[model samples]
Target chain A: MPSTAGAALPERSRDLRAFAGPVVEWAIWIAVLAWVFWQTQRFDREIAQYAFGAAGWPRALCIAAALGATGQLIYRIAEIRRGRAAVPEAAGPEIAAPESAAPEGQKPGLWQRAKHLPIFIFPLIYLYLVPSVGFYVATPFFILGLLLILEVRTLRALLGVTCVVYGLVLLLFTRFFYVALPVGRIESFYDINNAIIGIARYGM
Target chain B: MEQFLDGTFNLFGDGQAVLIFALGLIGGMLFGAIPGVNMLTLGAVLLPFTITMQPEHAVMLFSVIYCAGVFGGAITAILFNIPGAPENAPTCFDGYPMTMQGRSGKAIGAAVSCSAIGGVASAVLMMSATGLIASWAVRAFGPQEVFALIFFGLAVSASIGAENLWKGWLSVFAGLIIATVGTDPVGGIPRFNEGSFFGLEFSSYYLSAGIHFIPMILGFFAVSEVLTQAMHISKGTRERPKAGLDFPTIAEFLSVRWTMLRSIVIGFFAGILPGIGATLAAFLGYSQAHRWSKKRANFGKGELEGVVASETANNAATGAAMIPLLALGLPGGALTAMIMGIFQIHGMEPGPLIFVNSGDLVWITFAAMFWANLFIILLGWLQTKTVVQILRVPFRWLAPGILLLAVIGAYALRNLFIDVWVMFLAGIVGYLLRRSGYSAAGVVLGLILGKLGESAFSKSMQLMDYNFFGFFERPISALLITLGIAAIIVSIINEIRGADVQKALMD
Candidate 1:
């Protein structure tokens, strides 16, 4: 199938992606504020000697942050209501670089905008598995998975990176720093960890 | 003076001492530049092996490593945006930006010279009045005064690169709140620890010890940065950042001399405090540089002064930290504590008696550090010449390595998987915040400064019977806090008068 840019999209639909970006950012800001407010509210009441107790400092911070975010959001919305592109005036350079470089004449849907999803998700999976599958076992696959997702298909690049990164991890963490690193609970994974440790510590 | 001359002679004339210094320089730079491993790790690994060595050689080795390690971190911070240690975090703010701007060589050069300046100056101060300064620092800078310094640092930090004052403050507040997650300092109450589902007994148990800095720093600076780069690749917007050896000229060094000196003073003094050390010194140096700069607008956008301020102060702190350890028997930080362990292994205690009983040893250690700092200029430039080659590698290859390093960096802090999880989570948060016109640096500043300030705040409160106004009774504390408040007010006024406060935030 053609990429989003390869298939020409309707101008209105194309603009919708641009329109949705700020809307999503706004919603995220609001959600985060709510969560922070709720989290601070959950702390137990204050101690007498403490300056407003365990809850005071965080609660004070929560109020201050909420006020700032709320104020900024309100200003942004008001500026937009007056038919001004105020966000573009000072909107994030971090967001700008990618947004400006996006393929033209395309309708960038949520998926189009979120091409970084795999990069973000892969780490979570790798992190969750490390404790169970062992560091030495899981790392190569983790690296391979990232390389594949990022479209680095060259055999030389893939093998070179995998070996160098994995070797460095093994050498620096285990052999040099002497970190125990996680061995894992499953018998197979345990053996995998042991085999590597034995090879590293005592030789093959 | 005789001891000093003998110490200098020992380092230069003795083959063993010369060999040890060379070993320390290489080992420190190697370990300190690695993602998760640092000089402290190197020191810990070497501690058991140091027993057979002579006492003077053993102690001298660690001092050289300490000086070199602090500067080693700056190289990684400037080139890769991967601060090898927490103290190098501020360097990343400006240094990495310069790398992207193809000024990596200049940034590295600034880091090298200032680090040398800081290290040498601090060594001089440490040798000249170790006992006197340690005693004066202890008496003058109590909890209240320390709180004032942190308050001032945080206040200036919010305005460092932030265009919108409120956005910066919001970022700071969020950081302060996030820092309160593990536990309340005074009461040991688990503030944000997850409770059981449906009344089943559950919590992380150890969270009362609080969030670790390693995970948070890795998440914010490294992991999130990878995501930004990945986004560009996936969107077909990939562009290789500029990297070269356009090192700074002598004129550039002269330009930042004031910042260099000021930061060294801050870093040296900050290092003398028991719990607070190089990390605070670095952040404070960066913020103070921003506060005093004629071109404040250039900071965090790749200012040479920013790199000079942070690297110099952090290196300076290494020598200053030994002051308390040698003079008052107090460990200024973890690395110093390890050096104390070295002293104990050698059947020597590091108090006023150490100087009286082993005057030659103290001078030798001091001379070793002074010389070690001088060598950093050459070694650091060599590193800059070589390390910039990595920038030629594609982001696809570098990102995975960085992430893997991030995982280990986080977990190794306490060998807790929770830290790794936190690192990923913070990365997600950091990426989102940066895209939405928020200041991640402000958040970081708040987290570190707030953590240090909270304990001081608690102590000051108790010292003054919980009366908030009583803190201002102390002249130093009063002056610092007043300055902080004035800065906040001035920034707010600037915003009201239609200043471009939103640009830095949005940028």
Candidate 2:
């Protein structure tokens, strides 16, 4: 049984990828640790000695992270070898879990397992597009796409939300707050950004 | 006494001052409740407008906003896990859980009342004795003490949501690493931020400001939350929050009287520090609440005391933040820094001399804050009844809006696109970390305190000839470090003696 801390328990895996989630997370962390340790060598060698503290704080933290992760890994393996999770009823809150563990029912296909990918990917695309296409032009499309991705099927619901969200942002952020939104480099996006800015700033 | 009276008269006597108060109250609460936008945004937008207004009104307006804004974030933190500002992050721990359990009204009610109590109490303390207290308080905290305090904060934060102590510390270590991303505090050397590591070349000057915790908070709390809910929605396991305003009874407020008092003291002291403000205060309050709470296990599980503790301490910090700004000419946080700008715009400096030169302005602003905190209770009640209605909106409609708000909030921090990138990236990382049973709260705590800790640690080491034990030489630092060490030991003991340890090996 999972504790109340909301640690994503590695679901009783239905596939190899789902089962290997914990191992993969460890690998990524170890890679990060290795990179950080390597960077410690680049500190201004003259003034950056640990005694004087330049690369020292990060180095110390990286070392601690490695030890903590390695210890957990060893302990987890021991628990598995013992044939059950030793969830130590009072581990005191934080525990270990594999990422994005699928539901523990019958085997789901890749699409079912990866349903949450769009949430991540959509934001990345939105971020990537915002700078190039300008914020005002790209936001409506982004909201519409997100609405559809979230299973919002009604056309009225999609457009209404898209328009309301976009309009509210334009009114409050651009008009009232006077924040500088990203105007794109392309000629058309530039014009769109300017037009929106003009309309938002002065009205009509 | 005469200056205080005159300031009170000045604020209430002028009809324009009354209008300014209304605008600040309404504007502050509105901006404060919005997910991505904070009251600082309101302050920044109003900065130029302040130049055209009377100095006292301008100064009073920011003060009121500070009080109302800190309180406003609590509403969102309760109704949604999205904290409107960094200070309200801790409120999300229990407040959102309470909401999930369909007790948002009770959580909001406690938050509103405690926030008012914290704000008004701190304001009263701040008003009559600014000169004596600020002069004494600032002198007491040196680098050694500051480092010890941050050390204590981080140590206690390690076990916040972690059942496994190792996972909690790892989360904190990860945050410390992230905090070291931009620049080394001692020598200003850029750390893991950019440049070549093992023949890898990267250049991003924006790393100079480092990863602001605001983006990290928004990312972890808001963006990751939406993703989690989206997954749940897909799974058909989503729970809609039932709405009902259950204002805590008089007994409920009295129940946490100790928490309220302790938080006020904690918030006041924390606020007087130049860099440490409401965020630290809120976390400290929450941490201490968990420590002393009779219902400690219920803390992250939607405990009312959790909301009260966090909201009170943060709002308490709003008043205490003014202490340094008014008394020492030191801005405690971003909003206060802007208030300092307002002070300068009026051709006045904030130190002890300001008490003599512009005592009326200082006192009038104080008077307005006093009223603003009380007014927030009324405003908060109205907002609660209305904003709680957000729970009625389909989570699908609310979800995308939260993400959009997260984007705007992150970018608004420094007007940098890198912040947006950082926020999105944090969302992904946060999702993974949360899934792994890592405490995002621990990471945030470490991030919030890491820079302060590193800088203060370095300075303390220099002052004490790099001796680790030198911290114990100073009484205050010694006391703090001891308390921190004690907390770690208790956590270790708990882990060792935990209930199901033998079940794993024997089964």
Task: Provide a comma-separated list of chain B TM-scores, one per candidate.
Answer: 0.93, 0.95
In Å, residue B128's CA in model 2 sits off its true spot by 3.6
lDDT, candidate 1, residue B148?
86
For candidate 2, write residues A1-204 as lDDT tens digits: 446333433334323343255567577778989888887776644354336657878888888899878766665555455555434322222211111223455565798778867877888988998989999899899889988878899999999998888998888888987778788879999998999999999985
- What are the lDDT figures for the candidates, one per model? 0.80, 0.81
Error of 2 at A76 (Å): 5.1
Q: Which residue runs of candidate 2 sit more than 4 Å off their true CA positions? A: A1-28, A48-53, A70-85, A88-108, B1-5, B195-200, B499-507
lDDT of 2 at B150: 85
Instruction: Pull out the clashing pairs in model 1.
Output: B163-B501, B163-B504, B164-B501
Instruction: Show model 1 residue runs off by greater than 4 Å.
Output: A1-51, A70-85, A89-107, B161-163, B196-202, B500-507
State the lDDT of candidate 2 residue by residue for B234-273, as single tens digits: 7666777788777889998899999999999988888778
lDDT for model 2 comes to: 0.81
DockQ of the candidate models in sequence: 0.35, 0.33
lDDT of 1 by residue, B190-306 (tens): 787864444564567667667777788788778887877787788777667677797899898898889998998999988888877898899789888877888766776778998
TM-score of each: 0.90, 0.91
